[model samples]
Target: MIARRKVLLGGAGLLALGTGSCAGRRMWLDREPKLPLGIDAQGRALWSNWSGLEHAYPASRAAPASEAELAMLLPKAQAPIRPVGAGHSFTALVPTQGTLLSLDRLEGVVSHQVITATVRAGTKLSALGPALAAAGQEMVCLPDINKQTLAGALSTGTHGTGKGITAIHGTVTALRLVLPDGSIAECSRDERPELFHAARVGLGSFGVLSEVTLQNRPLSRVKKVVRLVDTDWVLGQWPALASQHRNAEFLVLPFTGKSALITHDVTDEPVRPRGPDTDSQTLMDLKRLRDLFEFTPGLRRRAAQMAMKNLPEEVAVDEGWKLLSNERPDRFKEMEYHLPIEHQVEVLREVIARIERDAHGVFFPIEARIIAPDDAWLSPFYQRESGSVAVHAWYKEDHQWMFKLIEPLFREAGGRPHWGKLHSLCASDLAALYPMFKEANAVRRSVDPAGRMVNPFVAKIFG
Candidate 1:
């Protein structure tokens, strides 16, 4: 199960990926009158692009510089407005026909109370990490990629690979949001408690998030020990591996049963020699080399297995944000589901068998990780032990065949799909899995009754 990681290494900032999904995204680039008097030009008001899919609204793109600007914009905003950060999520959470706001210039670290950071919604995770490190602090957890905005990550419960910790949203102690009625409010456990719980992982369905206060930790380097392990060994030792590392993830290749595990931990030893982040080009070259000879999937799989043999033993470095994240250059459609922690390995094994047997025409490493439950109302890991299984296929692959073949297995395992990734689950599907769905909806109703925060995707899941 040797997993290829080009998809995981692409770093933050979706707009820069130039995958061309947001081609109409240029509409908001023009100044007012052309923008404000009526629905604007070249770009749709709001849209979402991940891998390669787009859903946009004609009048939904709006960019507000301050809370006051956002307040003014919301009242005038069309009914289906939504705020966007870096557009990194593969989900349709941001697309709308009403108004899509970008807070690109609304970034900066506002206040630092020791380990706590109050940052504007527009701040990028990449920028936040270095700033926090300067203050001797760092985010406790983040996704394998750091390109998302602070507010966006929290909104969708974006997570990192860790045993007991939930996603990065779990770090939020407080938040400031603009309601649908153009009113602003601050939420926290001690503040507006109900709003705090729902809005923490609200999936941009409450209102425009203005700013956030993150609970951080002192900056420290992690020791990443990379090793090659057969799939059977990893499966048997997964429980122990989960206990051994603070943050752990494993990738299993499609054709081969061989697997490789990447483990990261804070270490006392100084950094060691590390390689560049771009390995996809090299792998692509290797694949092209063998494919010219008309190699079989089994042969291609063996070639990948051989590549890992001489791989670097460990990457020990003092990378602040860089070390904690990945650069996903390869474009791929992804669907991730979270089930009870006990069910993770079993679901994975079955998924592998199905893919291997059906030859579903999907290629990429199936990612597996563990995340403990959190109190966030809409978080998939809420109220139970959780395990996240990510099913990804290369962009050019036939998704219809692959996704069709995979969906049934996930359903049988009682898996909860990540809100910002891909999923077929609707409100009924989500409602049953998360008993608090109605309660979370209630919290959302109190804040944004106008549904200004919704788009087609959000409406399907939350309405």
Candidate 2:
């Protein structure tokens, strides 16, 4: 404990002794790379992910208006046909030189039966929420960001924070996929059980999901509350806190020694919609603190504590769909891992200590959320309930430190990387982490024997 305090104090003291000029600080903090041209040398239009960290110039780009159109194009398109959703992923999964397939035209709810809705895979969650509401249904859980397509979110095993709530893939009852050979297949627990489990979290390597049937619940309102709390206290009480709320998560402010605890619970209260977002403003404030006080660690800590302490809690009540998902205009590259429930806090503590002692430029808060277990073959939360830790770097920054420092800690704690996020694990490493990795790979190979769906990144993962 004394050593940890010394590290924190040492960081602040260095900031004080090595104070740099304001102009120099501004230049350093705001520096960013110049964006490339809209079109490449061959005149192929440029394509980039949400964070602008990954891009590719595909030889051909196709937007299939219907499943029939996709089926006809998949077998003939180039070797390594890749599907592009909203391009929200930070990894190289979407980058391919062969073919970029867009499902923009094939969207919306295809059909509905009581509590279940069969929606086209291309439908965006932002649009699907209202469509489901119109049909008197809503997804049981949704990821914090609603920009992802239903298929993309499921493929990546995206999730929201909540007790007893699994990732979106858990809600999938059936799926229709177009194999690399231009053949279509449908899978459910009752039919093609192996394929059902394997392809549910396929990471876009098994096949392209064309349609999905989700088990939804009746639309309802929820109350959301966000409050600042002492980081140490919250960390100690997290397990109990999580169990007490319907949905719960927290964001730990790196230098301030505090965290924002956010929770959502079922409520029938009158609509008291949330106000304009202040998250971006708060993030910038933290960055400014880093920039201005890099040389004065003590002053930085005092200033942050003074500014954040006693702030009023944010409260809102509205339909669960609207309040649960957020519109994240700011872009950042991320690395997240889901670990065994018991080790989450220990790993988080070590990571925070490492950052305070070493990574001085990091301003983004570390996000902590819990997830119930699921049966998806590649799911990080396979058989045991999980606690996920996600660290992010601003889009303009380099995340090499994440791979060098933090990833090793997570790996040591029996963590599994989020498929669409940054990680250094390969096929052999992943096989050791997941018990069903071999089975999933076998299913993928049977469907895509010619390797039409395998890009260089996917090859490294599935080799």
Candidate 3:
């Protein structure tokens, strides 16, 4: 069966080689956004997010090497003191004309107990995996993309798929925060419990996180599997699929009737490293399909269906941390919402229908994952198991259609928007979704009376 599937995939690749080259020129002519320059007028450098959607020319950029230095700079620094990670967020979270703070200097493992590790907030997840492995431990879960800093991921409630595994902040036992007033506070369930819950997924609005203590476990190996299946069939099996695997998620290819089902399970097998990623090549192929047949949905769907049939499943065996995350090089703007687990399939079906009917220019696959609920006050998954659905648009494409067609469906299903993604919700809309909205705001005001850390974007959400 594997040999036959490989032959079919090889044939499809040869066909794509001939057709894509002929049509590549048209794809390039589709009004891609020009890359911005590094420096701006007045000699200040321009800072842009990974997606090139949000940018700013800050008056000052500071990278503090120690927690004491960060605390000293916070109170006296200019207003709108925004903290930046890898600039991976698509929202306006990091843009600031005042002060831009980077904690990259104060990074890495600080200390470790029996089953816990104290890591600096600036540590990136990509580096944290191997660092933790060296100590014979690993995190409970990690997001699909590992380029984000630990602080950035926790601030936004980033998560991975698993029935019992919660978001990254769910594993955090304690944290040290530098308030806008330059005072340092250590918070946990025992001391300052309100601050602990509210600041767990604080969106960098409460304060800048300095160090976090995570409750991790001994490192283990896992087997990763990837297969293509019919979208409708997989939707029917999603509940069972999620329950059966240790980690499971799926990507729905819009216009086409197929989906990619990926699963990771604990195993004692020998290590077999993941092969060179074909995700980028597959993405461009889908874009070529859109470019060639945007006006004709039937032809586009038929072509995609034919190309994906009988594709061999990809298999890999490695440490859980290594296989759970991936390298995402294609830049795009995204919006994701977490809804009640029962409402996921129904809402997803409607989103696909609308995208195919109204928005024909979109070619990026829709990602769906499951996350267990946690106690963090501002977390989107607070107190309810959730199924998250994310939609993406190539950086150059207009994403206004998401607000019109996709967002309403998610909102109608009692969904909460991701903090780091694009959304049009104001304070009132958010208050209706999160039960602890008022309490979280109260905590923020207590810590930042002058609103030194509040930017225009954050003000709109927290007001």
Separately for all candidates shown, the number of backbone clashes (residues 3 or more apart, or on different chains) is: 18, 6, 0
> Quick one: best lDDT, which candidate?
3
TM-score of 2: 0.94
Model 1: per-residue Cα lDDT over 40-153, one tens digit each = 465543344645554565564667778898888888877777778887777788766666778887798899987899999889888888888888888757777778888888
Q: Model 1 lDDT vs. the true structure? A: 0.72
Model 1 spans > 4 angstroms off: 1-48, 282-312
lDDT of each: 0.72, 0.86, 0.88
C-alpha positional error of residue 438 in candidate 2 after TM-score superposition, expressed in Å? 0.3
Clashing pairs in 2: 12-297, 15-294, 15-295, 15-296, 16-295, 16-296
Q: Rank the candidates by TM-score, best first.
A: 3, 2, 1
Candidate 1 lDDT for residue 341: 86
| Error at 145, model 3, angstroms | 0.7
Residue 450 of model 2 has an lDDT of 86
What is the lDDT, from 0 to 100, of the residue 421 in candidate 3?
Answer: 93
Q: What lDDT tens digits, residue by residue, belong to model 3 across residues 176-283?
A: 999989899999999899999999998888889999999998898989998888999999999999999999999998888888899999889899998876676677
lDDT of 1 at 427: 85
